[model samples]
Target: MGRWEPNARGRLEQAALELYAERGYEQTPVAEITRRAGLTERTFFRHFADKREVLFAGSGRLAELCAGAVAAAPAAATPMDAAVAALYAAAGVFEERGDLVRLRQSVIDANAELQERELTKLATLSGALAEALRDRGTDDLTARLTAEAAVAVLKVAFEHWIHGSGEQTLRHLLGECVDSLGTAVARGPGAAGSVSG
Candidate 1:
């Protein structure tokens, strides 16, 4: 691809991913990424703050999508239901970019810095979901807890999707995780017929 190509941002992202996978995230530099993409350093800077940003660029969009879904959910939906619905909304994006998502995960898995960045992004998403839930009239504590739990569900489902066999979609895994959470919550600490305050 030429530097003047239409998808300069995409070209930069693809190039960064390829380099990150092959050379490792910390080992790869912005210059090499721009060169691989046939783009100038100026162009790379135009689209991303740095090499690491390439891997995390979509986080903003993902947060927006999840928060929007939460905000748009039916008024009668419970906080958990609305939050999980956001996960379902995000599933479509993950499903559409399965290969790239897996590759990106692999890159992050290999680098401690990237892993921390990933966690930070997830926390931001959780905050966004919590704010959306509050906007829906959920109380502060309930909204925060529900959002945190929903983000946990997302993390678990994503791990399973990336590591498990290709039989189940991300959406299916998310549902399974949500069901498991519900079961555990329902059983409580006294499921064996014992009660403790």
Candidate 2:
């Protein structure tokens, strides 16, 4: 029989992040996390597969959010438009969790393995998004490139948002990043302006 724990998962996550920031991820153990959370190892395993998953719990949710947003975007929307919609969806999911997400990023930034895991998760999201775009009648190659571009845009927007001051939304940051990227590409040599021939 399993013992019921009230808010055990949340407790575990909070404790794990606190310990990770204080002692570093590699130096922390499941036993210590459970102890800090005042829960048992069984309770910890009940909520998470391992310690690493605690920080990445949002990945699955964010992937689902992005794919669903892309699928639900207007049929007449361009690939970039659909991608922007998906980014807005991600912003909605992340907006309320800024502090926790920042801490998770901090922990990941300080660790190579966690950084790899973060990249792997983003790759997974890109593949899922490409599949979603294909379902919206896009060609495979175009869908793939579009999804990859979306990931890049999202990454840049997130970096800017995390490090910036003020009340800027991730959605706004995404739009600005996309606009900047478009401007840079548009102004490249031989792109409608710089024919010094």
Candidate 3:
């Protein structure tokens, strides 16, 4: 994929996404994407480093947005609360394009490499959240664990949002997930005073 072209970035990304969604990530090739977009091989390379990069281009930026949101939250907000707020803020950036999220998820689910990349992206976002928390004077261990738990809740909430009824918006589902997590944590290892005896 090396035929230099101009202004093909968006087209290339759109084409890659379409092909990935249509034929699965493993089966779709750079050439196929460029062909569908009516562009040359060089055009694709000029726009994206590779086919997989297209799926993850915005991941870093999204992580930054999430961390920023967390850092900006009021001091009164608990760490979990701040993380959830950050996730909700990021959802506002994402809620505009339900189709894109679904398509990307489909591709990632169908391909191990894409799934790995997604996991890595999630880890990166979690780390960013932890760092942002530290900036807010949260302890390191608390920040790390809280960030990880928040992302887990976000993942569950996102799935519920995507596959379940659309009536429960992401924010609402996130709140439910947070509450569920809190309840679970409150129960602790013994659960319902089992260890008291």
Identify the candidate with maximal TM-score. Answer: 1
Which candidate leads in lDDT?
Answer: 1
* C-alpha local distance difference test of each model: 0.92, 0.88, 0.86
Q: Each prediction's TM-score against the native? A: 0.93, 0.91, 0.87
Question: For residues 94-195, could you state the per-residue lDDT of candidate 1 as single tens digits?
Answer: 999888898899999999988998999999999999999999999999999999999999999999999999799999999999999988778655476565
Residue pairs with backbone atoms closer than 3 Å in model 1 (clashes): none
Candidate 3 TM-score, C-alpha based: 0.87
lDDT of 2 by residue, 5-33 (tens): 88888889989998898899999999999
| Worst 10 contiguous positions by lDDT, candidate 3 | 1-10
Q: Of the pair 1 and 2, which is ahead by lDDT?
A: 1
Mark the regions of model 1 whose C-alpha exceeds 4 Å error after superposition: 1-4, 187-196
Model 3, span 14-105: residue lDDT tens: 78888898888888888899898899887777667888889898888889999999988999998888998898987886787677887778
Q: List the residue pairs that clash in candidate 2.
A: none
Question: lDDT at 147 for candidate 3?
Answer: 95
